[model samples]
Target: MADETNNPDLEVNAASVSDGAYTLIIADFSDTDMAWEAYETLKSVEDGRSVEIEGVIVVRRTTEGRLEIQKATDHSTKSGLKWGVVGGIALGVIFPPSILGSAAVAGGAGAIVGKLRQRHHNHELEQKLENAITPGHSGLLALVSDPGEIKIRKALERAETIVESTLEQVEADDIKAAAKEVQGAHA
Candidate 1:
């Protein structure tokens, strides 16, 4: 799941980003719903050109201690199709496959989803997420590229969400090895 929107004309007010990645952990949600609400709010802001959202995943620890991960989908396409009668450009054209592919593999295909998959395959980050968000709690893990910090902060604040931890200028390999020190754990 991805935003798929690559509007070059879309204005983004942010400082020049260095060549690297960043990880933001939004935690302390009262429930999964609240976390999703915050995610939706952030997505809406991303849609409106407030910030550059690269990838997002929602993690929820169920009452029975199961970890659930939710990825972002092309909601704009669904919404446009549902309201196609209103007469507007199809979202597909606005967000072409080529653009989405380029964005996904901007740094490298392995650097984006690969890291997330590594996190899932190993139990380190998953365990940390589970521990941070106990049963009945929820959190969000977002990989943003040169995000507009002010806009993102305002959007989260408007949604009444608080960020628990943030690691900037993060390396993809470092993220992939977050749980490497611990062995014999599987997702």
Candidate 2:
């Protein structure tokens, strides 16, 4: 969900059999710049350490035939006008203040900005998915890992729940691998 991966047109794939490594497939289905982003967020639960839960981001083709490029700038913009102001003010420091200000401002004002950005990004992503979706073209994001049956199942279930409406369900094996070919073509 974080904008670390700019892949706007994401397709998540999580099958029970992919072992324990999360695999992300990014397909540039549009003529525009690859609009996709992906990154993992690690959390420390009560346990001593947690498994490195990974997130996969994939670009899918839409019915409208436009690549859903969730721009990085868009994400930052959604973060907030306040952060922009703070960032600008901090920039005035022209030194360590810029770096420190970023962290501090992001923590306070940036929090609101992050939430807004994420909310709008998700909304836009959904809209683009709806618009680009065609009968047979869809971008995909799959998170697969041999973490464990339980983990794998949970991941797959999560993906299924999110992708059910936007895309036609298919076995991971059945999901044709046009991503690489498509990406190469676009590149």
What are the runs in model 1 whose C-alpha is more than 4 Å off? 1-20, 47-50, 70-72, 75-130, 146-148, 158-187
What would the per-residue lDDT of candidate 1 be over residues 51-164, giving only the tens digit for each residue? 655445455556764444443442321112111110011111111222222222211223334444433343333333334545655655454444446656544442223333
TM-scores, in order shown? 0.44, 0.23
Q: What is the lDDT of residue 152 in candidate 2?
A: 31
In TM-score terms, candidate 1 sits at 0.44
Candidate lDDT scores, in order, read: 0.38, 0.27
Give per-residue lDDT, candidate 2, residue 38. 22
Q: How accurate locally is residue 76 in candidate 1, as Cα lDDT from 0 to 100?
A: 27
Model 1 lDDT, residue 169, Cα: 46
lDDT of 1 at 25: 39
lDDT of 2: 0.27
Task: Give candidate 2 regions above 4 Å deviation.
Answer: 1-50, 58-60, 64-149, 158-187
How many clashes does each candidate structure show, in the order listed?
0, 32
Q: Clashes in candidate 1: how many? A: 0
Best by lDDT: 1
